[model samples]
Structures are given as C-alpha cells and as structure tokens.
Target: MLDNNLDTIINKTYIIDKTPLNEEKIKKVIISLKDSIISSKEEITAANAIDIKNHNGNIIDFSIIERIFKNINNEKIYYGNVTTLKKDNNKYYGKQYFDKGNVLIFNTGNPYIILEIFLKNFLAGNTSIIVTTNYAYGLNKLLETIIKTVLETNNLSPDFINLLTTDAPEELLKNNYANIDLVIALGNKSFQNKITNYSKVPVLLSGYETFDLYIDEMLDKTFLTKIINLHLPMHVYINKNLKIDLRGSMLVDGVEEAIMQINYNGNGYSSAIFTSNDDNAANFISKVKSKIVTVNTSPTIERLMDIQVKDLVLEKTVIYPNKKKN
Candidate 1:
C-alpha cells in the first residue's frame, strides 16, 4: 500500500510538470513576435558551448553540455552574471542571471539539462514569436497594435509581451530557431544586414518602415501629468547632455496621468508619441491629429506640424479661430 501511494505521488508530480503547451497556437504568436523583433532590429544570436566546472575544482566534461553545444556554434555563448540561485540547506544549488550581451545564464549543476528541458517544454506547448527591429521606434506602433490584437484574440496575459524585449545575445536564437515556424522581416535594404542567412524558419518581408512619433518639448510636471493620463505607450528620449530630474517610474506613470489631466481640463485629449527622427515625428503627429485626437499645438508642435503640412498647404497663410459668445 505504501509503495503504491509513493508511485502515485511521483506519477502525479510528473504529470503536473510535464504538461505541454499548444504548439500550433504558440506558433502563430511566435511568428508575430519574431517579425516584430526583426523589424525592430533587435539582435538575435545563438549559444555555442557550455563551460562545466565541478565542485571538485576540476574541469569536467558534461555530456548534456556537449550535446547542447554540438548543435550550436562556440561564438554565441552568452556571458552574464547570475542573478538568482537556489539554496539546498544553505548551500548554492543553482544560479541564473543575465550575461554581458544580455544572455541569460543558468549555471547550476547542469545548466544545459535545465535549458534542454525548458526548450523542449516551451516548444512542445507555447509558440514563440520574435520581432526584430533596428530600434524601439522601428516598429513600435505596429508591434503595439499586434500585441493588443493578440491579447484580445487569445485572452493571453499581457506579461507574455515582456519576453519580446530582451538584451540577450544571439546564442539564444539557435534554441529558438529550432522551434520557430515563421519569421517576418521589416525594412528594405537596411534590414537585409540585420538577419541571419541560415535561419530554418520561413521568412517573409512584411513591409517598409513605419513612422514613429517624436517630442521635442520641455515637459513640466503639469504637462507631464496630463501626458500620463492619455494611456499611450511612448518612448522617452532625453538628450544625453540635458539633465532631466525625474524618476523612471515617474516619467512612465506621469505620461498616463497627464493624458487624464488634459481630458479633465477640457484642453482636448493628448497622446504622447516618440520617434528618433524629425520626419517620422511629424508623420506621427499628423496621424494622431487625424485619427487619434485633437493635439494641442505649441511652438515645437507647430514646427513639426508645419513641416508635415508644408507641401499640402499654401505657404504664409494665417488662419484664426472665430471667438464664440459665452
């Protein structure tokens, strides 16, 4: 009776741990994610070798590590500091953390063993989507829209989007490439240099570059508060030389708050947008005004707006709004 009970418990644990993800469903997600990553110019690399040093202070050959590296090249090893560790009776059991190229390292007893199991399970169940862009602004809007669509369609958790962004090295790409079903490329000649030649997944060039928003105004507390409430995702690029006194959370939170405040103040709704270039900035602002909301025009805003509308409108024309009787 005792033996039977133990076996049952062991079987139950195995069943719980071994439950797989839906590969077909995950494949769609992975394709979308991969396209976004590629279009964004995010770097993707592969793992090369596994360094094994046993507790006896001797270099040991781990078959699992050998097998893992055998499929990948040596140039793609991710080197990073271990961020977390498991403790067995107060002693170190395993360690995990990000490496130099943002590669995650799990250097416990057998890192490859854990990694293999993880990859196997991840591939077996969930589909991974990779989006590569040159920068955050590259496919920011499109990717954001796609993410929202995915969330609404599948009822997936928003936290899954966080995995789409990482500073990890290319080594991890090898494990990923093995299970990926689709790859989407963005940009024309510029993106050609960004992708690898030997990807096993089916690659599709989606489209040309999309414009991103840019803000050049000095954002004050009041304005920041208004911007925050708008509920728009914007990438803030402060000048490297200009010292802006604001906490990271404050900046992120303030934009949402500011949008709300603007709506309440009856000064029209404001949505914060960001881009790396002036033209893209103008295009984004135009799109927002036409499709999103009536944007407040400042000197900086006026300049960008004018640049965008210059060819469409006659030059040196002044128009004024009619004052209404209260």
Candidate 2:
C-alpha cells in the first residue's frame, strides 16, 4: 500500500542534482537492471508461464521477454541530463525542473513497458507509482523485485519505485492526493476513458491506437511491399500479399493527401513518412500534426524518452536585468 512514507520518498526527488555523477549513477541502475534480467531469463520466463496459464486469456509468449530487453536497451541510452540553465532571451534565463511530486502510472500492455516509463521518470528525478491493472501477479512483481534490488544496490531508496498489483487503482486516484503531480495511462480506448473519467490529476494517454502508414504511388511497388512486410507486426495488414487497406493504412496519391488524412485521423502521438523525395518528406513532416514526426524512418524509443522528459518536467524562467544592456 502507498502510504505517507511514499510521499516522503516522492518529495525527496526534488533535491536530486543534475550532475554528471548523478547521471552516471542513474545509468548504472539501468545497466544493472538489464544485466539482472538477462541473467535470470529462464527463471523469469518460467514465472510468467505460470501466470499465463492462470490468466487463461492471452498466452504470454517469448515476445515479452524480447520486449523487456529491447525497451531496456532503448531507454538505457537516455542519461536524463536535460536540467541546465539557459538563456531564454536576452533578459531572461530559463531552466527545466522535474515534477516535485510523484508520477502515478496506470498501464496495461507488455508489462515491461512500465520499465521504460519508470526509467524515463526516474532519470527525470520523479518517483513513480506503477499500478498494473492487468495480470500483475507475475512479470510485474518480478520486475518490481529486480528494480528494488537495483535501486538498493545503487544506494538509492527502494521506494523510488512502487508497483501496486491492485486491479482497481482508480480507488487510489479518487483521493485528493497532493503528491501526485502527474498521471499517465497506457492502454486501449476503453482503458484510457476509464482513467480519464476517474483521474482528477492530468492524464497523458498512450497506446492502443492503430498507427497508419500512407504509401504514396510515387514509390516503387516492390519497395512498398517490402516496407509493408517490415512494418507488418505494428500495422494491421488486411491482405497478407501487401494490399494494405484503410483499416491498416491506405495508399495516397501524393504527400499532401497523406498529410491531410493523417492530420484529420491521426492520434497526434507519432507519425512517420518513408520517402526518398526530399520535398515530399519535408512537406509531410512539416504539415503532419502529430507530436513526433520523422522522415525515412519510424520514431524510436529514444525520441519517446526525450518527449517523456518534457511531459514530466516544467520550465522555469527568471527574468533579470538585460546582460547586454539592451
């Protein structure tokens, strides 16, 4: 149960310094977590296998294991050193600060995605309270145990990470908790609506929305088929032969149409365009309304990590006498 002591632990995060020493320490924790999971792969799989059997819903497969390591590798590269004072303008100086209170995260997906969110929040110097509303008995607990060990090993408080296995986390949300500065919910539309309806705290919704890929006829047909195959796992392909429909994604006549369709129907999360035409790529990237836009490649986890920091942090500007005497 999250208690007053957890609030104290969350309060302590405000004092975390943005020094190189601190940065290295956080990085070490991530690296150690990766190593620990790798060493215990067999045991971890066995534990989750029982969880799958008990769940009797969806089978927990090896893909989860791969995602665990993949998320670790993706996030370990972000050292979270964005806290520096800079000139906002000639008369003002600005600096970024992590949230002074705890971040309450409710997610139902590959359990390891919590690890990614935890690392992002932890590096930004905000404590996380993870409430897994799905099958929390297996991988969630295992991940929490390993993370607590890593935290203690690195001389950080184990309370830095809290994983609540309770199914009804909305109960916790109903309280007027002063320490909860942010709430991030990752799941389907129904799940997101549940969180939004209950959470008085601000909510950032992620996951569950289908990512659309707009193929322009300017590209060669063979390359389009290859790209579709490469992205098969992420997108819903109506045809195995690569005849992608609007359900998965529709072929557009030009970049303008692609931009229009995506802007009108996209989830405003992340969007990408695979085009060799520099003008087309530039036009699509500039016109698309999604938060993260990329050219010739998909947005990476590193990009998400960068944006996560922005989401969890606030910018402070201190106006002063003009240094240039303007």
Candidate 3:
C-alpha cells in the first residue's frame, strides 16, 4: 500500500526559496540522482527489460530497448530546457525559480522519461509522487527501490520521492482535492480531457497537442529524403504505444493533401519544417496546429523540451524523444 501520510506530506510542500543554501541542497540532490542513475544503469536497463517482457501487447524491439537506456542518461536531467534557478524577481526585476507545487506523475509516455521530470521538480523543491499504473510491476518497483536507496543514502526524506503501484492509478489521479498540485499526463485526447476536468490543478498535457511536417514546396528530393529518413525512427523509438508516428508524414503534394494525410495519420506531438526559406518555417509555425514546431531539425521530444519548459511541454514525452538506431 502507498504511504498513509500522503496527504500530510503533500500539504507541507508549497514554499520554495532561492537562497544559496537551499539551492545547494537541491543541487546536491540532483547530482546524487544523476550519479545514482549512472551507477545503477545496468540494473536500470535490466528492470526495463522486465517491463518490456511483460508488456507483450506493445511491440518491443531491441533497438527500442537500447534507445530507452540511452535516453535515461544523466545529462538530460541537468541540461536541455529545464532551468533550476530563475533570476530574482523582486530586486533584479527578473524571474525567480521555485517549485511549481506538489506533483503527480502517472501513465505518461515511457517510464524512464520521468527521470527528467522528477529531477526538475526535485530541483525546484517540490515533492513528486510517481504512480505506476497498468501493473507492469518490474520497472516501476525497481526504479522506486533505486530512488529510495539514493534518497536514504543522502539523508533526504523518503517524502521527496514517493511511488504507488496499482492496477488503476486513474482512480487516484482523477481526485483533484487529493493534494496533487500539478499533473503532467500523456494519454489520448479523451483521457487528457478527463484529467483536465477532474483536476482543479494545472496540467502540462500532451496527446491533444498535435504535430505535422510543413515542407517547403521548393525543397529538393534529396534533402526531403534525408529529412524523412531522419524522422522515420521517431515512430518506433518514442513510445509507439503513445503514437509519436515518426513514420507517419503528410507528403506535400498540396495543402489539402497535407491536411488530409495528417488528419488520417500524424500523432501531432512533435512537428517539423524542412525549409531553407525562413518565411516558410514561420508560416508553418503560425498555421500548423502543433505545440512544437522545429525548423531544420528532426522532431524529437528532447528538442521539443529544449524549446519549452516541462509542463509547458509534456511531450516528446515520458518515453521521451529518441530514435532507435540499428
């Protein structure tokens, strides 16, 4: 069972300070997590293998598994768009970085991608509760155990990292008055709406967010092929279960054709523009329905997150953004 003190723990978390000491402590916790992840990688990958074995409904390829391990590398937790400190707002007239609030993470993309989210909130000084739903027991428990050890080793409160393993997390996840302040969810459109309606709290949501490639009509076939090849693996590598749909693209025969193909096929999480013309890139971003519009780069979640903050961006996803290379 989950800790009985869940409400008590969450209620105490709202205050955050940017004082040097507090920042140092959060920094230490982050470094410890990074180090722990590095030291425990083999163990981590082994745990992932078990989740793969049990989740036979989803096609799990070796290349995909390898991609999972690589995405969990520690650096991603420290860098990218995530910022630990916001400039002081009062005196400096700038931003002050602080914890968002107590957070709940569940059923979002790949399990490993939470590494960054967990790190981000931890740095901001908010406690994060991770609930592993659908009962693929191995990876979830192993991660909880590893995190528990790290927290304990550092003399950090177990409250800092909490885990609940249940067959149905949505029951708990839906309860807004349940002490969770922010929810970062990755589900289909219906489920996303359900979370939005149920939670009075803020949500950094993916799923309803869409993506499509807007190619310049004048681009050469050689560059187009390269772009297509670059994006191809996004489908398989970034949680096929979540529908990154890298292989799904709208061939740019014309505007109607583009819209029809994407309507039928694209996942709409991360989108792209393969254009030498700056005007084309800008126009696509303005007209397209995607939250992330990458110009001259492959559509990956890492790149997406680099473009936007965590909750502001819920995808390239918890599976996170990556491509399986053979």
Candidate 4:
C-alpha cells in the first residue's frame, strides 16, 4: 500500500513540473544521466540481479537498457522547435511542448520501458511521474534512486521525475480534477483496462504485447538451439508476465497457425520469422498486425522502445503567443 497522501504528492509535483524548461538544461540532464549509467553499471546490474533473483531467476533484458542509452543520443535530442510556418496576417502562436508540461506513466514490468519514457519526457521538457509496476517494485525503486542521484548531481530537482509504489491507481483516478496532461501505460490487458477505465486524460496504451518466432520448416535441434539461445530471450521480455512465466505464449509453426493462435488466443507486440526464402519472410512480416515487423532478427527490447522525442510533443503541443513590437 502507498501513503495516504497520494493527492498531496501529486498536487505538489504538478506545480514543480510546470517550471519552464530549456534545451540547454535538458541536454545537461541527459548528459548527466548517461554519465551516471556509465559510472553506475555495477550498481544497476546488481540491482537488476536482485530483482531477477527474487522473481525466480528471470533474466533482466539488457537489450532494453542499451536502447535507453541509444535513445538519449537520438538526433532530435537537441531539437527545440517544430518549424511550423506562420500564417500570413493573423498573429502567429507557437509553443513548444517540451518547454513546459507534465506526463504521467503507468509502467509495465520492464524497468527499461520506464527509463525510456523518463528520457522521452525529459528531452521533451515535461516532468514525468511513473507509477511503478507492482510486480517489479524493488527494481523500479532502484531506478527511482538512480534517477534521483543523477538529478541531484546535475543540480536538477528530484521532483522532475517522480515514482509511486502503490498499485492503487483507482484512488488518484477517482479525483476528476487531478492535474495531469498526458497518460502513457505499458502492461497486460488488465493493466491497460484499469488505466482506461479511470484515466480521463489522453491515454497512450501499449497494450498486452508478446512476440513470436516462426520457422519455414521444422529445423534441426542444433539450429533451433542456436536461435533460441540468441533470440528466445527477446520473447521472454515481450511476454506480459515477464520472462519467467509466459515466454512462449505464442510460438507457432506456420503463418496460418500463428494467425489462428492470436485470433483464438491473443496478440503479440512483434513477430519475427527466420527463413531461407525471402518471399516467405516477407509474407509473414506482412500478415502480422504487431506494431513492429522484423525478419530474421531478434525482436529486441531496444528495437521495441525506439521512438522519437517528438512523439510526446505531437500528443500535446504548447501554443506560444509572442507579442509583436508595439
């Protein structure tokens, strides 16, 4: 259970996040974050080790963390304006979202996903509040601490990024007047539904997602073992229940079988097919409705979380009305 002061906490933080943001500060914060990760690899890995151990030895997906670093270096990290053309005659108004706003996130089981969202919010100039996934609370707390340390060292406010441990979102959601601008959630169907049912704010739901691998024909055990060792781990991360429980929730043989499995069962976030024939690979990639499509590749978490900073701004654009000289 969380503190009884959830409402007070949100109100206070919402005011802090409203502080004006500049790209120079955002860049410095990102640089500080990267340096902290580089300097704190041992701690981060050890923290993950504890979470994985406590949760029955399920592996922490490294690929996701790698993307956290990569995403920080995205070409648009320094982008400050949308460069929209001002209309003739009327007073032009242009406001950059990243400069001032707040975003709320409901994390799934993956810490990397939360980290990705944090970076996106930071780069876009908005404060982020993360409601940690209940199942991965300990690991998420470590992430919280890491972020705090980085922010403190960079002379940034810890309130710039916030975390809540309670699984009780209903309490906050019940308050219709909560000061929230955007909501993003990544989780299973139940998690998605919970947010949708209560969150009146604009929602970006990364719904219950999994991944599958299909072979052209039943391959030899040796080949199977090699691919599994290399790529099966990705499926583990994609599975809604973490790598331990539902890693293979959607492994099928043919395209038809995979389609039928999902139609009768559920959908995956991504699909990968390894085949000697290009046409077969193309066909498989074409048919699946997963957000990501890949052929002969590990549907790594790094790839799954690849997104631009502009995405946040697209959802909520700040309108600036500059005054012309009197």
Query: Compared to the true structure, candidate 1 yields what TM-score?
Result: 0.22
Per-model C-alpha lDDT, please?
0.30, 0.61, 0.51, 0.61
Return model 3's CA RMSD, one decimal: 12.2
| Tens digit of per-residue lDDT, candidate 4, span 232-252 | 323421222222233454444
Q: Candidate 3: which stretches are off by over 4 Å?
A: 1-21, 56-100, 135-137, 165-169, 173-178, 207-254, 257-268, 273-285, 294-297, 301-326
Q: Please write out the lDDT profile of model 1 over residues 1-326, one tens digit for every residue.
A: 01122223223323332122243444455455434434533221111111112111112224433443333221221112132334443344433222111111111112222223222223333222333222222222333454545544654443222113333223333444332433333322233223444344444331121111223345454765455443222223233223453333223233333333323321112234432445545544554432233223221121111111111111222233444556
Q: Least accurate stretch of 10 residues (summed lDDT) in model 1?
A: 303-312
Full ranking by TM-score? 4, 2, 3, 1
In terms of lDDT, model 3 sits at 0.51
Once fitted onto the true fold, the runs of candidate 2 whose alpha carbons sit more than 4 angstroms away are: 1-21, 56-92, 208-307, 318-326
Q: State, as a TM-score between 0 and 1, how close model 2 is to the true structure.
A: 0.62
- Mind giving the per-residue lDDT tens digits that candidate 2 earns over 1-326? 43234345556654544343366787688788878878877877777777778762244445555664555455423233443355555555545354435788887534656677787777666778787755636776777888889888887877677776556667767767776888887754456678899998788887422244555432565755654554222331122233446444555556787788777655555666766668877887788876677665543322243235556665554456556653
Please give the lDDT score for candidate 4: 0.61
Cα-based lDDT at residue 75, candidate 3: 30
Superposing every Cα of model 1 onto the true structure, what RMSD results? 26.3
